[model samples]
Target chain A: MTLAAASHGFLSPTGVEIAFVLVGIATLGAALQTVTSRQLVHAALWLVVALGGVAVEYLLLTAEFIAWVQVLIYVGSVVVLLLFGLMLTKAPIGPSPDADSGNRWAALTVAGASAAALVWVVVDAFRATWIDLDGTVQGSAEVSGRSLFRFWVLPFEALSVLLLAALVGAIVLSRRGGDAKGAAETSAPAAGEERH
Target chain B: MHLAYPAVLAVLLFCTGLYGVLARRNAILVLMSVELMLNAVNLNLVAFDVWLRDALHGGQALTLFTIAVAAAEIGIGLAIVLLVYRNRGSSDIDRLRDLAERPAGPAGAAGSREAQPDTGAEATA
Candidate 1:
């Protein structure tokens, strides 16, 4: 029975669409849990799930290159960095009582309104539009590479520079305390000599 | 797949992130919320790219740029959050209220003066 639906042609909605909806629901559920989870570590882990779902969504959209990049950057690196931050900062591994503020109701209200507005506008705009997935594969690395290096070369280079700067900035900010401590230690003797 | 499917999904994800940002007290969680929002934007970009059927695949290319920028932003943001946690012994954003102006008391004025020379020495070092 399910195989019949899976074999449906391009004209009819098929298993791919079913999988997309399922992944979308899972991703949305994970995202909500990520935000609402009281445990900091758990929240980070849930974020991993949510990001992985997004990567799968990209693959379903047929952008294979972007999907891999999303997996590598978001699921692989960013979530690890977040966990490191949480551990380095000595955040409680268990439920954090202070994780939430008193403005939950207000925030939910705003979020709901904005989401409704965005969904309405998008559906109204693209209600009749249908993508022809049977055409040339646009999600391949070859096509993506050409587009990236050709018209978007400038922004791509700028992004690399930005990443480098952020790397340096993070090191500087995190090490500033150590630098300050070392300076204090070395300057203490100099101040004593000046006093004498 | 209908364009509205991914579009609506993105909107829902973006809104959840927004709620996280506004309601979360921990700075690290707030950063995670920001990441969620960025992912939502990437979904929209990719969906539009496929829908438009452009020769250059501009939406996907731009999505790549967005991913790179998001990585950088998260790196710097986490570093700042760690620094604050180290100095203050907590990462609660509500407790980080020192940015506001306050009336200068005699003790506060003298304290600033005493710290100035130390800062100058460190600057030169």
Candidate 2:
């Protein structure tokens, strides 16, 4: 099928737009819940929902490769890592009273202002623009890979190194607590033995 | 087909994340908020890339790199938060005012000095 023909067929008033709006709403709601939920676990789960909705939005935009990556990296790994952190740190599983600060009203105001400004600017700038989805498949894995490997290879490799460094840093930080605990344990036994 | 839909969505998501970062007390939740903001950025990148119809797919490519960076950030951020929880038994940012300057005294000097070694060790570790 030709690009223009495909877009013309799909772009007609149909369920796609409705689906996009619905998914967008769901994503926004999930994100709001993720941030506001008091229970740490619930918040994490809600984050998964929000992230998943983003993936769905990607799919709707015909970026299948990016969507799956979103599912795998974000919904698959990051949230799991977050859960691990929550568990290791013993964050409360239930609603936490201290989850909110007293500066919510102020925060809301700032957020509102920034959001309004960003929206206004983006809308004004792109008011007449429309994505020519009828053109080349920009979202395909092949196209994305070519771009990444050809033009963005340096940053891509750098990102890998950054991930490795982060892995090491996380291990070091978590291990420090373990080492301290071990030291306290061993020292307590020695002191007790000496007293005896 | 209008760019406004996704643009508005990204704006809303970004602001919600900003609110979460400023208002949330839990360190982990704050990190989650950061992720939300990053996602908003990704949405904008992809939307613009498509709208511009660039042959290189630079937006999608950058989005991939962003996802990687975000992952790395969360990993390190969570590690620091865990370390804080271990030392203080609480993750309350407000309670972390020990860095603030105290009245000049031997006690204050000793207290600040004592707090430095553990953090240094953790960093080196």
Candidate 3:
């Protein structure tokens, strides 16, 4: 289908519009939950919702490769690992006492200002240029993958090393009580002590 | 030529996620908020990619890399959050004040008793 037909054609236009609205609503809902949820796991789940919404948006734009990557990398791996970390660390399962703090107002003010600035910059930059949205991008994995491994190869390799180091660091940090003595010292007394 | 829909959605998602990052104290929640913001950016990228499909096709390629990098980031970010929780006895951002650059765990001279022990907190507190 031509770009104009996909956008202005009767069935496609309505279909696209409905998809856009639904995706937008879902994204907004998830974003709200990601911030306001008291439990860490709940927030992570919301992140999944938000990320999934993005994937759906990509699908709407006919970028199937990018959409699947969104699912595989973000929703599947990232959020799951995040939940694993929360469980392993034993973050408070119940409602956290101090979900919001005294500095909330300050943080909000700064975030608001930054967002405003970003929005202003983007709007000003694109004020005159009109974007044609009923277009298709040849985002097949072959094209994107080749480019990433070619001209972007150095940065990609650097990122790999960085990730490897981070993985090793995580293993070492989390496995601190590796020896029996440290393990015993770490947990033996905690079984008996109770604090209010 | 109407890009208003995607733009509005992107702005809304970003603003809401920003609010969450600012309002939430749990490290995991904060990380989730970051994910929200990233998704908003992804939407913008794909939208622009569709708009400029006949051009360089840079946005879609960048989005692919972004997804990969985001996954790796979450992996390490979650590990750090877990490590902080283990050392601080709590994951609340308020309680993690000692993480201002130097590692503030038992490796320092904070002493085990005074140092935060997440297991201890979980067992007793």
Best by TM-score: 1
| Tens-place lDDT digits, model 3, residues B55-77 | 54677767766776777677777
Name the docking class for model 1.
Answer: medium
lDDT per residue as tens, model 2, A20-53: 7899999999999987888999999999999999
lDDT of 2 by residue, B1-125 (tens): 56677888989999999999999988888999999999999988888888777777888998998998999899899889977776667777766665667667679778778768755543233
Relative to the real complex, the DockQ score for model 1 comes to 0.52
- In TM-score terms, candidate 1 sits at 0.84
Per-residue CA lDDT of candidate 3, range A1-196, in tens? 2544344433344567678788779887877777767767777787788888888888777777898988988888888888887887676787776776667787778767877877777666654443454444456677667666666777667777877877786676556455653666565654322221
Ranking of all predicted structures according to TM-score, beginning with the best and ending with the worst: 1, 2, 3
Cα distance off (Å), candidate 3, residue A92: 3.5
DockQ ranking, best first:
2, 1, 3
Error of 2 at A59 (Å): 1.3
How accurate locally is residue B70 in candidate 2, as Cα lDDT from 0 to 100? 94
Q: Fraction of native Cα contacts kept in each candidate?
A: 0.83, 0.74, 0.58
Candidate 3 residue-wise lDDT at A97:
63
What is the DockQ (computed on Cα atoms) for candidate 2? 0.52
lDDT of 2 at B79: 82
| DockQ of all predictions against the true structure, Cα-based | 0.52, 0.52, 0.40
True contacts kept of 2: 0.74
Itemize residue pairs with steric clashes in candidate 1: none
